[model samples]
Each structure stands twice: as C-alpha cells, then as structure tokens.
Target: MANMYDHAYDLEKAIRESEEFKGLKAAYDTVMNDPSSKEMFENFRNIQLELQQKQMQGQEISEEEVQKAQSVVQVVQQDEQIAKLMEQEQRLNIAINDISRIITKPLEELYGQPEE
Candidate 1:
C-alpha cells in the first residue's frame, strides 16, 4: 500500500509537469493577470460550478440556469485571453480523462469481456 501511494504521488508529479498542465497554468496565469479578463473568467467558472453542482445533487436545472451559463460562456468566448484559457482547460481535461481511462482499463477489460 505504501508503494502504491508512492506511485500515485509520482503520477501526480508527472501530471503537474506535463505539457497539458503547463499550458493550462500559463493560460490561467495570463487570464488572472489581466484585470479585464479575470472577473469574467471567475464569474464564468462560478456559473459553471453552480450548474454542475445542481446536476450532481439530482436537482433539475431550469432553463433560466442554462441560459445564464450560456450567456456567461458567450461573453467569455469573445475575450481572447478567456478563450485561450478555455482551450487550455479543455486540453488538460482531455489529458486527465485519458489518464482516468487508462487507469481503469484493467478493471474494464476484466468486467466487460463477453463470455466465451
């Protein structure tokens, strides 16, 4: 178990050093450093988190909530810095998703194989 935990920490370190994470960090810094983009990005993120939380709680997301998120997204999309930040975020998410899939592959193969 200790060795497994050590390996997990190593994986975390590797992820932090990865290009995807570095790109995300750079884009995030750029967005945060710019006063104009900072507020917009933060609001956009808050709205996104709220919507996600609502869904996770099994509560219905109203049309108004969806529209609010969409409007914020539209506004953010128009800002170059925010757009770049979003692009980097998507790349990082994709990389993390791939890692998650890879980690679960053995379990998936074991449980998902069709019986002969």
Candidate 2:
C-alpha cells in the first residue's frame, strides 16, 4: 500500500503539472514581464496582504483604507495582463480548494458535517 506522505507528494507533483497551474504560471509571467503591470500587480498584492494582516491581528480597517483597496482592485482589474493573471489564480485556487475538500472527507465523515 502507498504511504500517505508518498501519496501527498504525488498529489503535489500532479498539481504542479496541471493545466490550471501552467496557465497561472504563464499569466504571472506575462504580468511580471511588463514593468507597469508588474508594479500595479505588486501594489495590489501589498494592499491585500496588509488588509489580511490587519484582520488577523483583530485591527479595524478604516474607511479610507477600504477605499484605497477598492481603488487598487479597480486598477488591477482594468489591466488586461493583471486581470488575466487574477483569472488564472482564481482557477487554480478553485482546483486547490476542491482537492483540499476531497482530502478532508475522512475527517468530515468521522466527525460528521457541521450544521449549516
């Protein structure tokens, strides 16, 4: 029988070779290859990380900060290359989330599904 860790490594290899991961990598390369797009993407990512950090620390996000984040989101969404990268990222995230759910099914079965 295959060891669990070996199966996990196999899954990791499979994910790396998956088309969704390839598309994400290509889109990321396209964004990073252009200076303006790369700067914009980096700024957007920074804002997202900042907000996430604040939330994790139980800090309240200010209205101005929210507006700034929204503005950054709009700018990134308008950039064709960044937009494509985001789309590819979303596809990969969905695939990863699905795999996570599948892998956690045994725990769910043991503990039973939580109430909605």
Candidate 3:
C-alpha cells in the first residue's frame, strides 16, 4: 500500500506537470526577464504578503491596507505578462485548494464544517 509520503510525492509531481503550473512558470520567466515588469511584480507580491501577514496576526485590516493591495493589483493587471501570471497562479491555487478539500473531507465529515 502507498504511504502518506508516497501520496505526497505523487501530488507534488502532478502539480509540477499541470498546465496551470507550466503557464505560471513561463509567465514568471517572461516577467523576470524584463526589469520593469520584474520590479512591479515584486512590489505586488510584497504588498500582498504584508496584507496576508496582518490578517494572520488577527490585526484589523484597515481599508487603506485593502486599497493598497488593490492599487498594486490594478497596476499588475495592466502588464500583459504579469496579468497572465496572476491568472495562471489563480488556476493553480484553485487546484491546490481542491486537493486540500479532498484530503480533509474525511476529517471534516467527522467533526462537522469548520468556522469560516
């Protein structure tokens, strides 16, 4: 029988082979090859991480914080390569989330739905 580690490795391999992952990698490479796009992408990522950290810490996420992240997203959406990368990343995220849900189904069924 396959162990948990073997299943994990297989999942990783599946993700690496997914079209969404490939598209994301290609889009990332294209952006990294351009100085302006690379800078903008990094800035977007930093702002996103900051907002996420604040949320994780139970801090009140101010309207300004949300606006700041939105502003960066607007700018990112203007760049073709970066926009494509974001789309691909979203697709990959959805796939990963699906996997998470599937893996947790049994536990969730046993314990009932978790609080949002």
Find the candidate with the highest TM-score and give its number.
Answer: 2
Look at candidate 1 and tell me the lDDT of residue 19. Answer: 93
| Superior candidate under lDDT, 1 versus 2 | 2
lDDT of each: 0.92, 0.96, 0.90
Residue clash pairs of candidate 3: none
Stronger candidate by lDDT (2 vs 3): 2
Tens-place lDDT digits, model 1, residues 1-116: 57868988999999999998999999999999999899999888888898899899999999988898888899899999999999998999998999899989999999999999
Per-model TM values vs. the true structure: 0.88, 0.94, 0.87
Candidate of highest lDDT:
2
Task: State the local distance difference test value for candidate 1.
Answer: 0.92
Best-to-worst order by lDDT is: 2, 1, 3
For model 2, name the residue pairs that clash. Answer: none
Q: 62 in model 3: Cα distance from truth in Å?
A: 3.0
Which of candidates 2 and 3 is the stronger one according to TM-score? Answer: 2
Backbone clashes in each candidate structure, one number apiece?
A: 0, 0, 0
Residue runs of model 2 more than 4 Å from their true location after superposition: 113-116
**If both were scored by TM-score, which would come out higher, candidate 1 or candidate 2?**
2
Q: Rank the candidates by TM-score, best first.
A: 2, 1, 3
